[model samples]
Each structure stands twice: as C-alpha cells, then as structure tokens.
Target: MIDKAKLSALAHAVIDTEIEAVKALHERINDDFMQACEFMLHCQGRVVVIGMGKSGHIGSKLAATLASTGTPAFFVHPGEASHGDLGMITDKDVVLALSNSGETSEILTILPLIKRLGIPFIAMTGRPESTLATCATAHIDVSVANEACPLGLAPTSSTTAALVMGDALAVALLETRGFTVEDFARSHPGGLLGRRLLLRVSDIMHTGDAIPTIDEEALISQALIEMSNKGLGMTAVVDDQYHILGVFTDGDLRRVLSQEINIHTEKLSAFMTRECKTGRADMLAAEALELMQRYKINALLIENEHQQLCGAINMHDLLRAGVV
Candidate 1:
C-alpha cells in the first residue's frame, strides 16, 4: 500500500511547482507576445491552433478559450494537417503552432506549406534555437526550469506555463477588441448569462387578465382574493383608467391586522404602498432583479409608455425564467 503522508507531500509539491511555472510566465509576456496578438487581431480568417501529443491537449483548450472570448479559433492536429487536412487552413488565417521542444516532426512537416501559403505563423516552444521557432513570424518562449515529474519524462510544468500564456493572450485580445458582456452572451445564448441579459420584462411578465390587480376602492378582503386567484402573493391597486395607484401585498395585510383595522371595511388604497417600484417592458429582467434587491421588494408593476398598467412581475417569475 502507498503511504498517505508521502502521497500528500508529493501532491503539494506538484501544485507548488506548477504555480511557480505559471508565475514565471509573467515576465515573458514581451514584444513577441504583442506581435503575436497583433497578427491574430488583424487576421481576416480564423486562428488555427496546431499541436502534437500533450501540447495538443493544451492547444485545444486554448482554442476554446479564444473562441469563447472574441477571437475566432479552432484546433487542428499537426498529424492531420500533414495528411490532407492542411486544406482547412487559408492564406487569410493565422497559424499558432505548439511544440514544447520546438521539434515535433509532424509540425515541422507542415512548415513549408504554411510558409508557401503566406499565412502568418506564431510558434510556442521551449527551445528558441529550434527550427520551428526560427522559421516562424514570432516565437513565445514557454521554457520551464524543471518538470514537476520526478522522472522528468512526463509533461507537467512546461504544459502549465504554455496554457497560462495562451490564457494571457486571449484575455489581452478580448480587452483590445472592446468585447462586452452582451457580445459574450450572444456567443453563449444557451447559457444562464444569455438568459439574464437577453430576457426582457415583457417576455416574462403576466399581462392583461393574468396580472393580479384590484380596483383602488376595493376592500382589503377583495385584494386578498385577487392575490390568491393569481397566486402571485400581491395585487396591484389601479384607478378607473387602469393606471396603477398602489400595490397591496400579504405584508400589508399583516400591518393592517396589527392595527385591528377591519379587512372588510378598509379599502386597498387605505393601506397599500403608494410609492412602489415600477418597471418598463423593454427593461432587461436582470435589471429588474437588481431593482427588486435594492428596494427589498419581490414584485414590480410594469407600465407602458402611456403610464398605464400593462403587466406585473414578481421574484418567482424571474426565478422560473432563470433570470435570478
């Protein structure tokens, strides 16, 4: 059986080594890094990332990060590129080749075609003097002083440094392009972020007869009936023209009961909150959530451009729509 204490020490040491490897990458983000970003930013087509072995795994993640953030990119195996997949790349595209030793045979095999097509090339490698680094438009040095593996045969620290460098490049490009949260949402429409930014108050609000509303002259007992019928825990008190005058909630009933006021005799307008939060139909549901949080309220009355009550929304609605 393995000794638990020894296993724990080895795990901690591996984490510490990788952390230092990533931290060391900060100083290496220099002119070559800038040139690489510039080439990718100006490219008319996609950024094609090519790699082999363990470098391929890191390159796949780098491509995904770039695609999600604002840069258009995809991963291509260097072996496949040499076996007729090279047609997928175009002269307008930029090639980002990864080979920790800077001497992967498969990557070197495609250098001539990449050069012939006049496609801009960026190489990430550990050896600056290797052929892959020497023939590229720019070279990013991802050299680590030592591998985390005790045997020095497994890729550990070197791969971590390269992945961190890729992240830095993607983030720098994201900022330079002025990419906004809305832009990110567009790229990820099936995510919760998209639901929060894209869903509007009108899209989730209850309209017309579905809205829980009572006449301002109606008794507190009648407002309770409307709230129960709609199952929204609250009811809007509206004027004869259907313009909202106030909102009456279950909490209002509790306060009225404390005063011994007759629910049967007191009108909704007598105890309802006159100054209530209102929202516009075009407003984002996420914005409505913020307003609700700030005011410590759960419900909002929606008004159209003419200041007429058009709909209503509560925290439950936002919750069901995945906006909260």
Candidate 2:
C-alpha cells in the first residue's frame, strides 16, 4: 500500500501549487483586463463563453457567476459550436474563449467567423504567443509555472489560475456596474437571501378566517379550540373592534394547569400574556423571524397602524415560506 506520509505530502503539495497559481492571476489584471470589461459592458448583449473539456467546466461556472452578479452570460461548448451551436452567437454579443494551449481546433474553426461578425473577442490562454491570444481583442494570460499534478499532465494549477482570473473579471465588472444586494436578490428569487428580502409578513401570514383569534372574554376552552383548529400554537385575544389585546399560547395553558383553573369557566383575559409582541403587515418575514427568536416566542400577530389584528404568522409559517 502507498504510505500515508507520501499521500499527505502529495495532497499538501497540490494545494500549495494551486494556491500560488491563483495568486499569480493578480499580476495580469492590467490594461487588457480593462479592455475585456469594456467590450462586455458596451456589447448591449450577453457575454458568450466557450471552452473545451476542463476549460469548459471552468467557463461554465464563470458564466453562471457573471450572470448572477449582474452581467448576462452563458456557456456554449466549443465542440458543439462547430456542430451548429455557433448560431447561438450574434453580432451584438461579446465572445470570451478559453483554451489552455490556445490551439484547440474547435475554437480555431469558429475564430474566423467570430472575427467576421466584427464582435469583440477575449481569450484566456496559458500561451501568450498562441494564435488565440494574439487574435484576441484583449488577451488574459492564465499561464502557471507548473501543474499541481506531479506528472504535469492534468490541468490542475493552470485551471485554477484561469478560474481565479475569470472571477476577477466578473467582480471588476460587477463593481463597475454598481451591482447591489437587491439587484442580486432579484436575480436569485428562490435563494435564501432573495426570499428573506422579498417576502413580507402580509405575503405568508394567515388572514381572515384563517387567523387564530378569539375575543378577550372567550372561555379558555374556546381559545384552546381556536388554537387547535388553526394549529398555530396560540390564539390572539382581541376586543370587539378586532384590536389586539393579548395572546394565550400553549405555554400559558401549561402554566394555568398548575393552578388547576377551570377551562370552561376561566376567561382568556385572565391567563393571556398582555401586550404581546406584534409585527406590522409590511415587515419582512426575516424580521418577524428575528422578533420571534429574540423573544423566544413561536407566533406573532400582524397588525396595521391602528393595532387591529389583520393576520397571524407562526414559526411554521416562516418555515413553509422558506424564511426560516
């Protein structure tokens, strides 16, 4: 069997090599990088990224990062492009090609057409003197001193350098475009931050007949039925005007059990927690979650400016809405 020490040493060496490769990308962020950004920013169309094999994998991830961060971009396989996918490219789009050797036949096949369209071409290659690099409107050198693979065959450290350089390009463009959290949220509506920022109490709270509410004078038995039927673990106690007065929860019931109170005779007002914490209809669900967590409570009544209970939301509601 291979010795453990040799395996550990190899792993550490690979990591150290890739780290240095990524760090070297910082030095190449110069005039050519700025020109590539200008091309994409002024294109008025999507940034089309193309590559092959390992380079394709890196290009795919970079394309997604660029799209989500405010730049519109997508990945098209170089081989597929030669087989008709090249039609996806348009005169309005800026093409960014990736090839470690700068001589990938599939990319070269389409290079002339890319130039014929008179669109901007950005190349990321390890060989600065390569045809792809020389033909590019702006060339980004992602050359590495050595591969992380001991055989120097696998595109390890070289691919890492390209990946980091792509990220640098995307971030520089994102900052220049003034991208904001809200802008990112809009693009990722199903993500946690998006839901936390976009969803409000009014959107997910139980309203009308769905709200678990009882009159302040209602018997504890009636409140228990409301809580059980609504399954919110609590019932809001409101006056005749529907103005919230307090809330009786499962905890309150457990506390009253010690006093041996009569459910049929005792009123909710006698056991309810008065002036309970409340939230506004316009409050973000994330904010409601904070309120619940801060007070160690599980439910909250949503009200308007007049303090009238308009809706009810529980921890389960936030969970169902993916805000938890």
C-alpha lDDT values of all predictions? 0.92, 0.93
Q: Against the hidden true structure, what lDDT does model 1 obtain?
A: 0.92
Tell me the tens digit of each residue's lDDT in model 2 across 1-324. 879999999999999999989888878988999899999888788999999999999999999999999999999998898889989999999999999999999999999999998999999999999999999999999999999999999999999898999999899989999999989999999999999988999999999999898998899999999999999999999889999889999999999889999999998888999969999999899999999999999999998898899999999999999998
Clash pairs, candidate 2, are none
TM-score of each: 0.86, 0.95
Q: Candidate 2: lDDT of 264?
A: 95
* Per-residue lDDT of 290 in model 2: 99
Residue-level lDDT for 237 in candidate 2 = 90
After the best TM-score superposition of candidate 1, give how far the Cα of residue 32 lies from its true spot, in angstroms. Answer: 2.3
